[model samples]
Target: MDPVTFSPPLYKQRYQFVIDLVKKYKPKKVVDLGCADCTLLWKLKFQTCIEVLAGVDINRAVITDKMYRLSPLPCEYLQPSERPLTIKLYQGSVAEKDPCTLGFDLASCIELIEHLETPVLEKFSEMVFGYMTPAIVIISTPNAEFNRLLPGLNGFRHKDHKFEWTKEEFQNWAQDVCSSYNYTVEFTGVGKGPPGTEDVGFCTQCGVFTRSYQSEGSLTADSCRDTEHSYKPIYNVVYPNLCDGTILRNTVISEVIYWAESIRKNMVECAQEDETVDNHSYQASSKSVPSVSNISQETCSTEEHVLTDTRGDNEAYKEGNTIFIPLAKLFSFSKVQKLCSSLDHLKAILSETSQVELNSDATAMILSAVEDIEEHAEACWDTSCLELGVALAECEEDWDEELCDS
Candidate 1:
């Protein structure tokens, strides 16, 4: 069978169920036993709460074949979570005991248990619940009762499945594991059956086991003893992150402040132009100069400019050594507003960033206390750093006003 016959695709639904649990549990260390193609690890890596992500499969060739897909994408380089993401893929078996796989907060065995021989299940259970003993374990397998509903599925869902179990049998096995390992178990499933088929439950059955007692002989935090290693490490990746606050202080904060000052300057120029128009003494500058950045003078303000080019003659803002690029301003340009269509998004970034101080309304920002940002900026400024956008400015302002008021 192609395995893509089910609605929403059965594999995808299984992965989504695990992802939902991950978001709720917020596990720090996660491992997937029998992680064949590693599609689950790829999805799990995006969850910020997972500090360490591991995948183990019996076939070295099978796991290594998908390693390239795990490489970080280009955009992930620019923006990463506060916690560094570490992903490791291993070549091993669920039935084997590996010390290196111990102490995971969550362990998964998606559509893998039925593939093991009946006798091997003992070893699999012992290795997972007894030895590695993660705080939580999720095991999913095809529900034999739902097989009659699948269009072309034969004797079993897959040829590799050594044996399939009914819901009662699966639940009995799960209860045995829980009893043996001192873990609590809950049974749930995904993929709805046809209208009158509710009695059999979902197409895929899953069991979630949570540790009820601490494992005996748990390794000390500073233990010098080296535990045994069994799984062969295939690939590892450490993503660039904002944990150190340097990127937030340097690139994000500096760019925001630079744009905020530019907005203030433009607002002042617009007011002056209003005064000049009223007095009938307005004079267009001798030379028409374009802006230093892509955002033209017309785009930054609602009013028109007809006097001396007041924006520092299109000069880049520089202080001492660092030349702050107006990336925020560039993003707000009419040509590129899609990148930053609303200033509220920018405000959210500023509000969440560590070492960044925002006034009660988030109109003003303080960054001097941060290590890499300017120390002199510890004092609050009088300008609203993020009050404008391009075409979406008005909607953004309304949203910001409502959000900030709360």
Candidate 2:
């Protein structure tokens, strides 16, 4: 079959969502499940610095063609031009394959769910989540409600699609499936625009499942009470926007954490046995002890508590733990800033010389950090500034007290 072509608007929106998710996870490897023509994989390989991109599909024809095309090149070959992205293609059902064996940080199943049977769907979820343990998984399908909205004359039905679900149905199913495998699900789509907007119509339903946790056990009998009886008009109900690009925020954060952790690990590994003592003596001689005030003691304490909480629970870590230790706590901001500055300086020097050395690890690390910074910055924007408001009020109170004393 010819590859399914998406409308430009729809394809771009979906691609953005996937890119955000990938950046958030910053997975070393990525796989596209049921990748018909492997076009997505090809695009992703060209776009991201992910170590590997594997495309899997059951179609023998696509796989045979891909193999024939790629076989001429060695197993790994550098492009004649400076191409940053790379991908490999495979042939198999997700239900039958292990993504971990293939080494994927993320797996995508765009427009593949509706074609699956329940048992196969369960198997497919298990195969990916159990083995790959990717930080993120993205899936998209047609929104059934939008299909209903289509005139019957549109003839949009596919012979292979066993079922099409409305947003509600898709959300519930995604939640259930993800939860079964200890994953959190977020719903997005081509309609609406983002998560919560006024526009609601036929658009592709997109679901993102992440290996993250939130506080639980808050629900109570009283919480179940529904007092509002009057029905609101459909116009009053705000239709949630589909993926609004923020989906990439999490990917960015994950990448940052990954890079930060990696850098810390490398530094620790390289440190001399007496380096800490030597540094301490040097600081003492200089009479300039580094102050801890720059770091949030509270945040550090919270992270430590979380680590302690997980110490005995190996299963919990495997499930998904988002409680990350901020790099600021582990490393001096001044040192990090200096390092970044030095890197920038080096880049300029390399450009001047026209002799750019490709440090894949360093490049990946920097990209991850950039993504993380962007993700958290966006998150901070979304939250109301109630704490800031309280702080301002307290400042006013202190000012009044100072004036009275004066």
| Clash count, one per candidate | 0, 15
Quality of model 1 by C-alpha lDDT: 0.70
lDDT of 2 by residue, 259-351 (tens): 444554443444444587878877786656476465688999998789678654212111121222323332233433333344453233323
Model 1 lDDT per residue over 262-286, tens place: 5445544665787888555323432
- The candidate maximizing lDDT is 1
**TM-score, each model?**
0.63, 0.45
Off by over 4 Å in 1: 1-5, 215-217, 221-226, 245-406
The number of the candidate with the highest TM-score is 1
Positional deviation of residue 1's Cα in model 1 after best superposition, in angstroms: 18
